[model samples]
Target: MAIDQEILEVSSMFRLLMKKASQDWNRGACKMNLTFPQVQILYSLNNRGSLKVSELADALNLTSAAITGLTDKLCSLNYVERERATDDRRVVYVKITKEGIHAIDSVKEIYREMMEKMFNQLSKEDIQHLMRIFAQMLVNIDN
Candidate 1:
């Protein structure tokens, strides 16, 4: 079977764009002053709401101890609150406060704008094609 050069070209282009997207996230987000892990926790809370440390760690694929450590740091900074369940009294849940919500909301726009600007550099048709391709990839991964 003959290899398609155009297929290889698009694959390389996808890889390059993915690399650039990751790099741009690291660079522009550092200016926002939150580490990537912190951002992940806050974003998780924003989306999932109150969850125990174990749950958060499970969701993030980190150890419970690591999640406890992260939550402690966030707690000290007043970004999150740890509350013992009234019924269980043994289980504790990490809850996002208004500050944490604010922190998450704070970064949402900058990240979106950064990527939007990058995508805007492409032609509208190219952007639409890329979006559909990535959406299919996501569906494949989810399934």
Candidate 2:
């Protein structure tokens, strides 16, 4: 297969778009005291209900100690709590508290507005096309 200028241009544009979108997301995330990992811990807890520290650390690709530190801070702030499993005393689960939920939800509105701004110039069809392209790309990469 031969490369084409159009393909190269589109690929570059896609990379730049992804970069810009990530930057905006980081900016919104920066408003909170949490780093990306800390915020991600909250996201994981919210999504998964509750999980052991090792499990959360594995999901986030961090060491248990690193997650322990983040969880400690979150615990001190009352954003999350450590619980002992009733069935297994040795197992511990971390759950996001109401404060954690509120903190994450508060940033969502602004971040969503940022997403809207990024897509405001595009028509509905364009947005749909972009979604299709992204979905296909995920399939290709994930496999």
Candidate 3:
């Protein structure tokens, strides 16, 4: 194939892979009454303890407004709580509750299962090559 044709094919395959993976993740998350973004928030809080709304937005590559909305839903579900910083009352921090930790654990299981199903056929060498390719692509995109 021509270089242009090869690039187009790779792009198309990338999109398809992302779409299918997203669909599978969404389906699993839905079973737990959560969306992918919500799960991402919980996962972040679980790992990082607590963070400000703006910080969460930056970490998730979402807008502050978007993070607020997601946190609102998570708060309603009692998965997380919003509290004002003691010394800096003006600042609000989002913390994952015990329930949030439980939820994230479940989400992690779903993620693991999905990844296994998707990549189990790949050999270790193939996985390493994929990791390198993805790393290079990210570097290129950042540039």
Candidate 4:
């Protein structure tokens, strides 16, 4: 196949896979009264400990306004808290609460189960290869 044709086919397959995965994830998130982005924010905060609003926005590739709105909602849910810097009141940090940590743990469990069901038919070697490919793709995208 031509290179262009190969690209088109691969991209189409990726899009379809992502669509299905997003739907499944959304369903799981709904069970916890969370949206996909809300769960993502929780996970990010869990992994990074705490971050400034701008940093979170950059990490998520979302606008500052969007991040603010999401953070507000998360705050209302008691999943996250905004703290001002003691020395620099101008800087605000977003940190996950104990409840948020618990939420993240719950979401991770759901994600693990979902992945197991999705990849049950794949051999171990195949899954490893897919992981490698995905890591490389992420590196390529970053570059």
Q: Best by TM-score, which number? A: 3
Candidate 1 residue lDDT tens string, 39-93? 8999999999999888998899999888888888788878899999899987889
The 0-to-1 C-alpha lDDT of every candidate, in the order given, reads: 0.86, 0.87, 0.93, 0.91
Better of 2 and 4 by TM-score: 4
Each candidate: RMSD to true structure?
3.0, 2.8, 1.6, 2.9
Better of 2 and 3 by lDDT: 3
Per-residue lDDT tens digits of candidate 3, residues 28-90? 998789988899899899888899988999999999999989889999999999999899887
lDDT of 4 by residue, 11-70 (tens): 999999999998998888888888878887898999999999889889999987888899
**Candidate 2 lDDT, 44-124, residue by residue in tens:** 998899999889988999988898999998898788999999999987889999999998786667578898999889999
What candidate 1 gets wrong by more than 4 Å, as runs, is 1-8, 136-143
Ranking of models by TM-score = 3, 4, 2, 1
User: Which of 1 and 4 is the better model by lDDT?
Assistant: 4
TM-score of each: 0.76, 0.79, 0.90, 0.80
Please identify which of the two predictions, 1 or 4, would achieve the higher TM-score against the true structure. 4
lDDT of 4 at 7: 93
**Of the pair 2 and 3, which is ahead by TM-score?**
3
User: How accurate locally is residue 103 in candidate 3, as Cα lDDT from 0 to 100?
Assistant: 89
TM-score of 2: 0.79
- The weakest ten consecutive residues by lDDT in model 3 span 28-37
Worst 10 residues of 2 by lDDT: 103-112
